[model samples]
Target: MPDPSQKRPVIALTGATGYIGRNVMESLIDDYDIIALSRNGDAKDNEEHVEWRSCDFFSFQDALKGLRGADYAVYLIHSMLPSAKLTQGTFEDMDVILAQHFARAAAENGIKQIVYLSGIIPPHEHRDELSRHLQSRLEVETILGSHGVPVTTLRAGLIVGPDGSSFPILAKLVRRLPAMILPSWTRTKTHTIALPDVIHAFQQVVGREDVYSRAIDIGGPDVMSYQELLQRTADIMGKKRRFIPFPFPTVKLSRLWVTLVTQEPKEMSYPLIESLAHPMVAEARQTVPGISDGKITYEEAAAAALDEEQKKQEEKKREQEEEGSKTPSPVRKLKQAVKSDVRSVQRITLPEGQDAIWAGDEYLHWLSRLASPLLHIKTTRTGVQQVYVLWWKKPLLELTFDVGMSQSDHAIYRITGGRLLHAKRAHNGRLTFLQIPNSRECIVAIHDYMPSLPWVMYKYTQAKIHLWVMKAFGKYLRRWKHRSTTDTKAAPRQAMSQHDSTVR
Candidate 1:
């Protein structure tokens, strides 16, 4: 037990970069002196009161260095990476070995408590290969308990959050698809907890003195079927989805299907699909004191996940814009003085005769080509040219570009409204539509890729790449306009609709 008179306890955290681990880190930021451990070294050089250490979890000696001088150590590491060489047949064996290693290390370091976030398994359930993941989790719980260092294990089901492996994929699939072919397991009941709620549970365990060496099940207010979850998510997304549950056995096929749809690695999806095959609803009526009462409802948890996903998409779009603006185009450089002057000088002109007929045509053409691979571009005939200009209040350069190969096949592009536009792509490849304000001159900026190669080695190579294509197209169009000698009029522009900008 931590002495009340002592200063904040030094707590070591494993899996600091993981989804659940990140939430725990944020919750403990001001409360404990965190010693964060990850295979990748400390992300930043300086974290106030947080000591960042790098460790290879597979190596006992390496992991021990991070556990030193820690009162409580959170062991959140799991072997979910698809590329790991461990056989699926021996997952439980590997988990036992790892847990023993961690337990020994914590005991040697004189750590007071071993806090672990584990999966919940209902008592009396049939234990099979599908339930192996939970069994392994339970094995770790026992291993930690044997070490004499009290362990507090918080068992939870699917963690609902933007970054969570299962929920984000589920939410995106529900939002994007109008119909789904669900497995037989869709009828199986499961429990869920919001990422925030899971973090709160950990905080409670960390702060409580009487809570050691216990395995507690934590869940949100509802225990619903997989089909019900899908329906609720669909309702929130404002989409009607048809879920057809075939009588076919789905362990193998469903795993493959999830892998394709979510683009999550096979290793991660396999265990999850197997777990879902069994009903994962909580059986125990007892709850952790103080922590369980504050649990959120399924609807609220779903809403939080959706909100976080939307925010993540917006942030990714901003990052892409910033990256795009930094790499200057050769043509942009030539017109830099004029371009800078144009921002301070705004004017609208209308073309005469047939020339005016194609005023919106060129902007639409540029927009279509620019967002082509990324968005299903379209235009409206209402003589409206909606432009959105976002200037950085700071000195940072902004740029955006599609990171995937093949424009038409890219996940970032999608259709919205009657016009062609560049929709935002979250860092995780979730697509979102941008609401643009109406303006005569809207700068649709994109980031160009800057290679890490030597400047001389790749400067011209970079110039000849995608940017060259855009530059050449722009130049040819300008020449065509000059030769035609037609006067074109700018169309009326409108600001972004308030309704469009707000998420319901």
Candidate 2:
């Protein structure tokens, strides 16, 4: 619990887009302002109190800005399966360099504490016997603590989540492989935790003075072998595996085989295969209220993750159906002077109603991307008007569109003014969002009159444009559904605050 006397502390979270980081953000959002650091780039839309900061973790100066202005900075970045080839030493060496840079920046920024999530070490810690993955975790922990800020290290074993790397790999193998050619490594005992448990553990350590500057192990209560985990997961997935133990150890060969079977990259599979030999179990766990109490069983965890995943899959299917229904029908088509100039396509409905507001946002994002590869867009809001400046290929062809009276069900926009005189000729442009009679599906239609272009050219060109936009819009809807589903998995926070500032 945070002290009521002090203001809500800001948490600078690295890897905010990662599995653990995202979950942690959702878990602690009510208690702290979040800074989501990601490589691909964070959304620029101003979220309430969550500020997204972009940083190149390798460069101290680059990370300095993002690390600054925070009471606690959660270090969740790791390169187990490095996306890029390492020119210097190994992944461990790169990890150490990154950690040193982060620590330096954090100390300079006057960060109160640093929380790091690391891989769990086996019950019996042998420096010589530690896997490369485990060794890297320990080394990074030491480096972060070496700096001025107090470091809270929470080491976890296999994390089971819907989209997590480990559980899916095991589930996929069980689902795909007819029978298991079990290797000796399958018998190695390791602790495993549900994704929720890991999130809980991170939150539990946030401002706890007792846990600060100490290494703590966190895992689900159950400890089991790889074979048991595989079998139990298979059972939950309703797939039975016939395991036959094989005495052979072809560590290198297995990596290639896993890549071939699982279709995962060597960078990801190689490290995972190499790390399987170690028995990863926690030696001791810190007693935290939410984390250490009332643990769920492995079977229960697997079933719960799978159940939630199944719901998401179903919701996505519904969203797809809703998007497919948006096509304009023959009756909805405008009769133009040239028949070819007017094209309308329409199709069918989902049982659950999709949010009209979200559909509008999707349409906007789709429209912003539809026209050209070289096009750029700038959006600003003034009072009730949404101003969009579109540069089509060249600055000379720039168009400024002013959208007014926009609502969940409909919106009206006109070319207002631009460098091109012909744009002013465009008028009465309206996007109507209609809900299917009794279904959750919505039909979004955009019909505008552009008298500036020749009727013949307008007809065919408009049809082509509509077709492309429809295809692109379908993809955008899919992405939206995916993102929304992922957000829900975080279990949300009341009055959640996210910074509108996004980092890429």
Candidate 3:
């Protein structure tokens, strides 16, 4: 055992239980003390240098506490899976909210550097043309660096691991199907990286200052087509399979079949399948030095992944047998509950020189105007904002400003008590207006909100209306931004014309 008196740098790592995060933490366990952030806020038994902290990325306070004593941080979060039972936003929007909070918290806590795992972004003049999954990754990379923290971004293509989402899906498909129907996308060239190599790359760059704020592409020695990857996996498994080439690329149909065959959630598979058309090979200019040596080949990676997966299956079987007589844990029961909380997020362009406080104030007033005939909004002397529908006895929704947590660039409003909210269970529910520091983008988000109505009723009525209203408000903000710019430009011309008249 290492000396307890010796000091080691504490690295605060998000997604600590995820596949890549678990591997990365294990790789660096000997050299660094790690603050592992989990939603459940629990640590494993007998972890020598690891401290577990419960962190909800949706809450800035939680993120701030999680990174409090860390010298550096690692961000490996992806929002493809739903956080709550009822999530009413796109995965991209959800990812943005989480990134904004984490970035701000990291900056506030004086973290020196952040190492982020991201997906490779193909060369595109218009970022809108990129797949949704890759686009979110790129956005996250930008946000992590926006808070004045040096972020080392390692972008990888398909990571071949023992039991992750992407590689396991591929392996399952190969093993289950006797004959594979190959689409045109199967010919797209992409790179692959072994899990061990990825962990090695992280170990090299996490504390290094030279590669700070740089995006590095990590991959295996071989850049092969997707069809070749499938074939290599088949060869490793010693399975005879026939591939029939279909000339057309229909990603929508392909994603469905892939999900069905692999038994993976569509949330995970769809974005990946959508990205198969893009060539994801790494750029030579973005490669890291010295770390490229001794990279594993695809064949070697496939064999090792298969062996490891088999071992994991055996272990899982033994554990299941042991736990057969035991009851489910409370956390498991909570996850299985039908009525879950709600999270909604939307990004809006902030007008020039406006802050989050202005946005939050504008939203309250604007909402009243938008629903003028139906709803009435009022604010009390205590700064509690309430929304009432047609002078009903009770307010539909009530928002109390959290002054202690609110800042110039960030505003927090707790969903205190309301007729439309499940007040008893809405302990953490809040509405936040977040202005990204040094940028014109802002996020309006609702987190952990539970509705008073039944789940199905709320899903159809309140959820749909909320989304529609947010979209309209987003458009309204953009129009305000455009009008603000126009008015500013017109003011200069108006002054010049008056000066010319006076001179004449």
List the global CA lDDT of all models.
0.59, 0.63, 0.83
- Model 2 per-residue lDDT tens digits across residues 1-504: 777578888999998877778889999998888877875445454377688877767444567888878889999887544322112125664565567668878988999889998777775668778777777788788778765789998877788887767787787788799797888888888788888888888888898888889877778878898888888888888876898888876667767777788776565677777788888777745435565442767788888878887897798778779887543322233121122112132211312345444454445445656644444344433212232345343332222222222333322233343332245453443333433322355544433323345655644574466567666675555455344433321211100122112211
Candidate 3 per-residue lDDT, tens place, 1-504, comes to 234577888899888888888898899898899999988766454378888888989898898888999999999888887778887767987888788888989999999999998877786536888889888888888888888999999888888888777788899999999998899999999898888988899888977889999998888888988899889888889999999999999889999999898867678899989988888888888887755332898888878988999997798778878988545543465467534788888888887877786777778878998999799787775667889999697999999877667767887889998898887773689999887656888888899888889989989999999989988988988888433333322332333455557768
| Candidate 2 accuracy as TM-score | 0.61
Best by TM-score, which number?
A: 3
Give me the runs in candidate 3 sitting further than 4 Å from their true place.
1-6, 43-46, 325-339, 436-439, 481-504
Residue 410 accuracy (lDDT) in model 1:
14
The numbered model that scores best in lDDT is: 3
lDDT of candidate 1 over 27-93, digit per residue (tens) = 8877688888876665656488788888755445565687999989999876654112112224454
Judge candidate 2 at residue 160 and give its lDDT: 83
Candidate 3, residue 300: lDDT: 86
The better candidate by lDDT, 1 or 3, is: 3
Whole-structure CA lDDT of model 3: 0.83
Greater-TM-score candidate between 2 and 3: 3
Q: Give the residue spans of candidate 2 off by over 4 A.
A: 81-89, 123-125, 285-294, 313-504
Clashes of 1: 27
